[model samples]
Target: MKQNAIRAALAAVFLTAPVAGMAQETDLAKRVEQLAAELEKVKAELAAQRAQAAAAPRTAAPVPSTAPAQAMTNAPVSTAWATPAAALASDTVFSGYGEVNYNRPVRNASGTQTDVRRAVIGIQHRFDDKTKVVAEFEWEHGVVSASDKGESEVEQLYVEREFNGGLRGKAGLFLMPVGLLNQTHEPTAYYGVERNFVETAIIPTTWREAGLGLSGEFGDGFAWDTGLTTGFDLSKWDPASGEGRESPPGSIHQEGQLAKSRDLSLHGALNWRGYPRLLVGGSVFTGKAGHATPGFAANDARLTLLDLHTRFTPGAWDLSALWAYGRISNTEALNATFVGNPTPVPSSFAGWYLQAAYKLWQSGDYVLSPFARFESFNTARSYAAQPAGLGVPATPYERVATIGANLMVGQGVVLKADYQKFRQDKSLDRINLGLGFAY
Candidate 1:
């Protein structure tokens, strides 16, 4: 956007130079000086803008949207959280995103529902050029109350400080640099109505922890981050419930709510973006989950997860793929304690996916990108060994195929519709429609 402004200003100068020379014959020299001054000012302004643009963290979501990048400028505020990066246009910047969705099962007609999936408000306030504060509040499922099935939570709250040598540090609650979507799941940032099951079920999307961390970049296009943070508390696990079978870490995460600090977790990630329109990165997060809680059967247990992802945007094509795996250590004894439970602790879970999208058409400020994704996920790939004739049945990998299109309206609003087919659970197959915006 700043580039466009620069071009327009230069054009004005060139187009008006001759006119001023002819119209102001007596004060032509003075007029020329005025124009030169204005031109210099415009250039300086654009240069500053370009610097800030360079400082904003780049996302791994598909490119060619052009809309989301401009979403911030279209908003009421001048900036948003620029983490692992530095610079903000205003001292107090408000930026956010929201999405509402409708889903209907293909075969089970009774399972039709519309929902206000999520609404989020993010604020980034710069205390100085080197330091800033970022806080984001989120409302999920529309309403929030004791009786409502909705929730209100703090998605992120942290203070970041820039140090010499290109290093940056942040403290407080922050989102982990995990999977592709975990750091950039702003509705419009991804395709489809619901997030792909592989990410949500295997990696636990929106995962965050309270901790301190450092980030920096070097060597052409390499960036690295390492941090110590709060982790899961296995004592909270419910063997009687199927939560573990859904998302193991998510079911036991602390989310910084009086989080147990007895056993902190460590995480690290490295990314490379030297190639234009291409991004490749991988991350690892591992920690003990017992938190040393007394009488915990899995006191010696640990959790480890890792993933590799890549996104390449060439011309009108947006293509990406990811693979993630997670493990729970020493769950055998833990599962023995829940012998009769319906859902025992799983030994491991993993998933992978490949997705592609094409910019099919464009008109004015509207863009339509049709996409397809195929994924195979297993939340319960294996269980801890149990007594003979008493173990839970073996689980099958669930395969999914999703075909969808996202229509970008102007800068930030997007209309999406998709159909998803499930291989193992036909009842889960559904058609979905959604409207989302980021600004």
Candidate 2:
């Protein structure tokens, strides 16, 4: 009985041990299968991630820190003047230009002088997508005084708007867009240390007035500008004023903001840029200058100006030419009105200039330009033969030649040296040195 019982117990033990061992083995196999499945799923996921990554578009690299800053800066830029207001910068923009000059006359034209020729500060503000305002103030000779050549003036203060179809408009005190230099007279834009004698005497650059104007491009490089402005007052004209006949036409300009508008003037300019490197233009201004002189005839005191200009650039050479003719009717009446004045207004005045420039040398950061200009003008081309031998001085005529060179140290900074020879009543020669910049 003991033996049977022991054997039965041993058998049971053996059976139970084997069953438990099998079950444990099965569990281990299941765990291994599950782990294999999980491993395969992870591998598939990784493959998919890599494929997606490869299919995606790559982004551009950030601006390189080691690249040349000037190369980036040289990129072209569009400003609010051409684009809509919405494209304008949100912050106010400040810009200006300045020039300093040293002049010495060889023939005693004037004593040698060193002075700050011009210092200008401009402020620009964009009010909306289509509206902007600009104002500029200028200081000449670096100071303002009662008994000095220094003075302060407003160059521009105007509001501009952009319309559809390449049309634009501006109002307030602004420059009259007649001549190239009238609108863009920064020193760096031209080669001379001083402005050309023709434009200065005839067109009167730095010419601005309170008026409204329109500018637009029609098509195929055709453009136009027109304006209505306050006319000059003949009452302010004096033969002995040493301005009109004795000096540049600019001297006779009544730039006074509160100027009498008894006579309004109309001016228009047309330009064509049909060729890639050439521009041709013309302008006309007509009005009664004798606003209301006590003795002058009504509208008989008219002033008319006709100007034609052209600029050409071929290779490294630039050439420009301008011819301007001006006429004043009824100068006899003006002479009769002011018989005692020494300086008498001329009935017909004319001027012209031709300029040429060549790039002598240019490097990555430096440029040298050599230029020459020829100008001729007669302020008193024709005046009423003084009534009863009132004795009006001889007409003033100027034939000038300018030779100069400009060294550009940077983008907008220039050093200029020039010599001017004059052929008129006296043969005068002058040497000028100028430093100018814009930013």
Tell me the deviation in Å of residue 72 in model 2. 20
TM-score of 2: 0.77
RMSD of each: 11.4, 20.4
Per-residue alpha-carbon lDDT of candidate 2 for residues 1-439, written as tens digits (9 for 90 to 100): 4445545655554466434577876865665566556666767876796786556533211111111111222211112122233323233667788899999898775688889999988887767556778888899998899988898998888887878876778888877766656766777767789988667777788777788888887778678889898766666665567777654356557775677778888988888776776778888887887667565543467888778888777777778888988887776756766677767777788889998888888897788889999999887777756656774665666899999998887666889999998887444688999998876
Query: What is candidate 1's CA lDDT for residue 110?
Result: 92
What are the TM-scores, per candidate, against the unseen true structure? 0.81, 0.77
Best by TM-score: 1
User: Where in model 2 is the C-alpha error above 4 Å?
Assistant: 1-88, 293-299, 385-388, 391-396, 425-427
Lowest lDDT 10-residue stretch of candidate 1: 60-69
Residue pairs in collision within model 1: none
Off by over 4 Å in 1: 1-89
